[model samples]
Target: MNEVFDYVVIGAGSAGCVLAGRLSEDGQHQVCVLEAGGTDATPLVQCPAGLAAMSKATHLNWAMQTVPQAGLNGRCGYQPRGKVLGGSSSVNAMIYLRGQPQDYDGWAAQGNPGWAWADVKPWFLKAEHNERGADAWHGQGGPLNVADLQQPNSLSQDFVEAGVQAGFARNTDFNGGSQEGVGLYQVTQKNGERWSAAKAYLTPHWGRRNLQVRTGAQVLRIVLTTTKAGLRATGVEYVRGGVRHTVHARREVLLSAGALLSPQILMLSGIGPAAHLREVGVQPVHDLPGVGHNLHDHLDALLVADAPQLTQSFGWSATGLMHMVQGAWEWHSKRTGRLTTNFAEAGAFLKSSPEVSRPDLQLHFVVAKLIDHGRQTVWGHGFSCHVCVLRPQSRGTVRLRSADPLTLPLIDPNFLAVEDDLQRTVRGVQMARRILAQAALARHGAQELPHSACAQTPGEIAQWVRQTADTIYHPVGTCRMGHGAMDVVDSQLRVHRVLGLRVVDASIFPSIPSGNTNAPTIMVAEKAACMVLSHAEKTSVAAD
Candidate 1:
């Protein structure tokens, strides 16, 4: 028999780390964090731009690919998930955005009570220590370190000006009072290094008595036992390295393995779509029909251009690989210069339609521009703007290929499946084109890339959105939380058919937040930690 834990957090991604850190602070509960991959001890995992290099490292990533998306000209889209300690936060762009207030209210309307913008606002303020100091909306005393780039790129300025010229309101801060505007992004960084979940939450408490962090430990399934009353999650069975072991949870099993894997683990433990579970050779423990139904991801394709001067555009190097190496050296020795910037420094949030109350599209401007898959960089110089429709109307599903816990689940985001998702994407492209056409960018000879759809008819633009759009890497709502019968989790984020199990990641989001999801994800964890701690305290009082 393996050891038992009070709390077994499945994945040590953004949410798991926070949960583990906060839950163990009381010195009473023993928290075991099961990460499928190893520790985030890589050299690049700390560098801001290391995300691009790390993206190609499949060994450190689960690296799941989607089924051929009809929306992207039948291309099987790529979805890279961090398999290591800090999870995707370790590998993501590190851009810190909380989305808009309306995004939360929309959740409340969908039946996730106590989760409106105002309700969750405190968590955002409570978890941040921004370089800009405290404000009405931002925090000053928080675990996470957020800051602006020391050297704002000139390309970022032009991109903002272009958007303004295109009639976008230039609001500098999205996380502030309003979000409809253009500006440079604040990132999850310290000094200039990446502030991954480990750096922010876990590392500070590594040697704590109650926190047991296990890397390279794959949790096979949640084990349950039953009394006369109902079912209870008693523990978890996991495998580490090559050895199979079982670790029991005496209190609760928290699944923070992110959107893709969390739902998969649920089904493997027999808590998903009934028919689907039986087909995959798992007896249905619960008939939660919405375990993996609401699959959505923001799609953005590169709009490349030749730059005026020598920008960091990885787009132009038959020979600049040396520069990248030298730059990495400079960053490692002293965290400054080119390596400090998280490429795509500039960004904006815009409403695709005035009728829509919240912003539907997001864009980020990158300094380096090149042609052809970032391989054939134009030597002269170039820039690219990535635009994504934040709220996708189309939904998809994630189903298990088999019952094996070791295998990756089959994921289909169904990108652009809904007409509005496609329509908004087309609008996003139009808005971007308008930005590029501005006189500011015109000074830089902003020639649009070949792939940018030049179609005048909205129908043609929509078709291009379907054909060329790609995931901007924000996927959510698989184990959807809401009021409908198909909803898997309720307002408190508890699974409909299970007791003592909660999903506290981006996966629990009913829809993708209207901006970058990293900061909002942390907020969810903060809220979840409070909810969990309160329950644990209540359970303790009862025992007394």
Candidate 2:
């Protein structure tokens, strides 16, 4: 006999934590969530400023790198994912944006019901606890905390002023009526600390007897059965403390392991393309061609500049060290100061051309001289402005490098594969240069690093883009949602040809949203929780 629960959620990530917390709220059902990573108790995960340390914390981060990208001049791109509870929400920059409303409407038009902007806004509201209080568009007293930065870096403000100086409007809320404009980002923080999904959803429910959360438990694959109805997932096989164990689900097994790993788990469970499964030595249970096909991520190019002033910018000088000590003391005492920063504090949404339907480019203004994902250290103080394409045209794949479940999956975000992607990226670089070159930022007298600002030709910009462009860490659509043959899941998030299984994470997104994905992922879990509970109620009524 095996331990059986009403629901077993794989990966206690942004979506998984929400599902575990919401589904077990009735107190009658048993819900179990398994996380591959350990607890989120470390200060590096709790403090907002710990994001800087997280960049190098290999143990806490997946730190997956892509194969050399042909579009990037064969440069290997760094992809960092949080492995601890709350998943990437615990380690990300913490900006909370629901993206453009049309992003959801576009999904509905593409054959997904109940996901349109009008239909899904409530879910977003239901999961948020905005500091500004509730409104028709925003909600308060919800699980996830959304707050304005307690103390934004001065350079961040300068970026906004520069954006305005460069002819862009100032937007107060990216999650509000419109996303177009430059402004300070509202982060997923509460009282200067990082408010990851685990903090909002899982922490409060830890005492619930019906809910069990197992950390450091790596799921190998989903257990499935061939019934008269079709393929139905029954349980999951996982490893903990070097011992293999099995847990059965009485009702459902939800996969919420994110975009890169969700599809990898599906393929490991023998549910992907039959031919590819065979190649990986996996027995085919189902032939879903779209399991890992629609892979995409927001590709970005960065512009690093030299800032001589250590008081306004972050650097490695003795004065900078003293400032850090004082900032730490301030945060420890009042939860305020530089320690509250999420690094990419200010950003914007803008269009490259009038013909573009929505903002095709987004910006992240970092108050530090970031290079190579902060892996390469610079000698002095400066700043970086990252310009990423909003909706990339190129697609890639996440494939099994081997049959072993513990083996890392091959990630190929074949960025800039489309010529237009490169062209648009060049436009984004040009836009960033325009904003950085404005009078507000120009006051710092920052000079471009590595690449000369003198290079202004289209070919020069295009070559520079190819030389430096990489991911902003928003990977999605590996298991896309739709009604088409290649679609992995339907509108309700159920696998197309499987029963009692659902992917309740970003992997199911038909297309990536326009901004940061954490908010949208939380919303997806809220909606999925309702669908699961509704189906259970209907089943009980029929059983009676």
Candidate 3:
């Protein structure tokens, strides 16, 4: 006998958590959430500073790599996704941002009604519980807790001063009326601890009888059936503890496995391009050509500098070691101190060129010399800054490596494929250099590392960008929502040709937003929850 659920959500990530939590609120629907990863209860996930270590924790991360990108001079970029209860929200830097209004307005213009900035702003507010209290732009009494860092590193504060000295305004709130300017970032934390989506949504509902969360369940495919109308998703097959199991969904199946895996999961279920499915040995069920197309991400270029005189900056030293131990004690005992800092504490949004209408480049200033996403070790004290294109024109794909569910998918971001992307990246790198050279930062005797110092000219900077640029972990648009021929989902987030199925995550984004994507992803789920419940009510009324 197969266990039945009114709704089966694949992937207990940012969106899945919200869907399950919201759908089961009325106690009328039996919601089951399936997560590929295990628990997110470890201190490594709860402590905000532990993000540096989480990047290299394979068990907590998918740790996938991309196919060689020509735009990156044939370098294979690393992509680390959280394999835990909260998904990437469990292991991210925790910066809370909702991008520019135009980003969502553009989505509405692309034929996705109700996704305009005006429509989505309320959802963002609904999902938020800003500790700074409610305002015209923010909300209170929401689930997710948003607060200022209890203890920000002095170096991070200096970075903000440097940005101001570099000619950019000093705007305090990026999510406020304007996003242009440099300032300290607010994070998704509560009392100096990370407040992931799971903590905000799923954790509180653990005792709910109607909601079931199954971790460590690797879904192989969505079980589809040939119905009287057309193909409909009936259930799903997954493996857990080396045993295969099937679960039935009486109403619908929601795929929220994120931008990369969501598309791969659909394609594995024979829902992608027909030819590609055949090549990969999966029998085609529905020919949705956009299942794995339209992949894009923010390509980031780093500028590292050696600032040995700045003792506040994190690095390898006797004093730094002592500080780390003390900070750990403070965080464990009092839940406050330097250990509460999300290293990329301060950042800014600026135009790469004066002619641009809005900010095209975003900066993340780290209090440590971060290299290779903090996987590689740099021995001395220093600082680093990352500048990424807010909206990239280059597109790519996510194809299957083989039919085996255990096999990872082939991910190609195809970064900088468009010449304009490269030019913008170069301009961003120059701007970052100017900020770092400013008197506020330069006072610490910061010297550019050899990797970035050699690139002085525009030609040299372009080559340097090709050699060094990589993703800042914002990958989206594989199963974009639109009315176009290539769109996989409709405005309501339903799979176009398949009934009783939908994708609710960053994958459905028509295009990438202007800044960190976590906040916008949560907003999408908040709005989707309302839509799902409303649809269920209408269906019940019609049947009655």
Candidate 4:
């Protein structure tokens, strides 16, 4: 017998966790959350510092690679997405940033009505439980905990000081009045442990009788039924433990599988462009041409410097190894120590040029030398700074490689496809170089690594950027929200022509934000939860 539910949410990711917790709150609706990966109960997930290792752990990370990009000298970039209960949140750097207000305003301007800064601010406030207490710009009592780092490396403070020395103001809160300065980043952590979306929303409601969470249940496709009204998503087919299970959704099916997988699921369910579906051997159910279009991400370039004299910095050495062992014990005992660090402890948002209206570039100053997203091992004490274009003109697609749901989708971010993107990135690199050269960092004996020091001229810098730049892991807009010819979902996050289905993750973002995307994604889920419940309430009234 097939199980039934009022809502079936695919992917127990950042958005899905929120949906599951909210939808089942009234204890009236049975909501089922399906996750492709297993548990997030291990120390690797709970510890904030585990992010370095998690990036390489295939069991926890999707570690998806993009198609060879012509722009980055035909190099395929690394894309690490979390596969466990919290999704990317379980394995991310945990920086809690909501981006600039104008970002959502831009979404509103692009025909997504309720996505303006004013419209979405309430959701952000509603979802946050900030450690610094409540104010006009923040909330005090909510599920997701946002707190300052318990123990940040001294180098991180030096980075912030260096930014101030480089002419940028020091901002205590990036999510506050302005996002245009440098400071220590507030993280999604509580008492030094990672406060992922799953930990915040789902874990607290684990005992809720109406909510069911299924791990290691990979959804194959949505089961759509054609009725007189339209094609409505009724259920889903999933594989678990070598057995297939069918579960019916009485009211709706919510796809929160994230930017990369949401559109993949839709296409596998035969709801993408007609021609592409046919080519992939999937029978077309809906001829939505925009299902997998408008893909873009923040392309980041790194500047590394060897800081062997800085004993506080993390690296491989007898002293560093001993510190790690001691820090682990300290974390295990009191949830405080160097192990509490998120690595990317400090960052800034700056304008690539003074003429720009808003900050168009972002920086992440890591306490350790991060080469290849921490996949490559570099033995020594050093620091790395990341500069990414806040917005790129380039766009790409997420298309089906095969009709099989298990097959990875063809991801083409087409980074640096536009010459303007490369130029902006070059400018960002120059600015970062200036910041690093500041007396604040220079006093700590920080010296530029060979790769960065070798690139001096404009031509050399641009060439170097093309040769080394890759994604900083913020991908969005594959199932973009808008009211245009290429839009996949409406302002309400409903699939353009589908019934009883919605995409409520970063995938629905009309455009990428100016900073990290996790906070914005949580806010999206908070707002989407209200929409889903409101519609259900009205439906119940009409039925009565």
RMSD of 1: 2.1
Model 1: lDDT to the true structure: 0.81
RMSD of every prediction: 2.1, 1.1, 0.8, 0.8
> Which run of 10 residues does model 4 get worst, by summed lDDT?
444-453
Q: Which ten residues in a row have the lowest lDDT in candidate 1?
A: 370-379
Q: Estimate the TM-score of every prediction.
A: 0.95, 0.98, 0.99, 0.99
Residue 48 alpha-carbon offset, candidate 2, angstroms = 0.7
Candidate 4 per-residue C-alpha lDDT over 277-379 given as tens digits, one digit per residue, 9 for 90 to 100? 9998999999999998999999999999997877789998889999999999998999899999999999999999889998999999999988888988888
* Higher-ranked by TM-score: 1 or 4: 4
Off by over 4 Å in 4: none
User: How displaced is residue 271 in candidate 2, in Å?
Assistant: 0.4
lDDT of 2 by residue, 271-353 (tens): 99889999989998999998998999999888889877745777777777888899889988998888899989999999998
List per-prediction Cα lDDT, in the order shown: 0.81, 0.91, 0.93, 0.93
lDDT of 3 by residue, 1-544 (tens): 6899999999988888888889999999999999999999998999999998987899999999999999999999999888999999999999999999999999999999999999999999999999888999999999999998888888888889988998899989998999999999999999989999999999999999999999999999999999899999999899999999999999999999999999999999999999999998999999999888999999999999997777798888888888899999999999999889999999999998889999999999999989989999788799999999999999999999999998999999999999999999889888888898888888999888998899999999999999988899999999999988999999999999899999999999999999999999999999988988899999999999
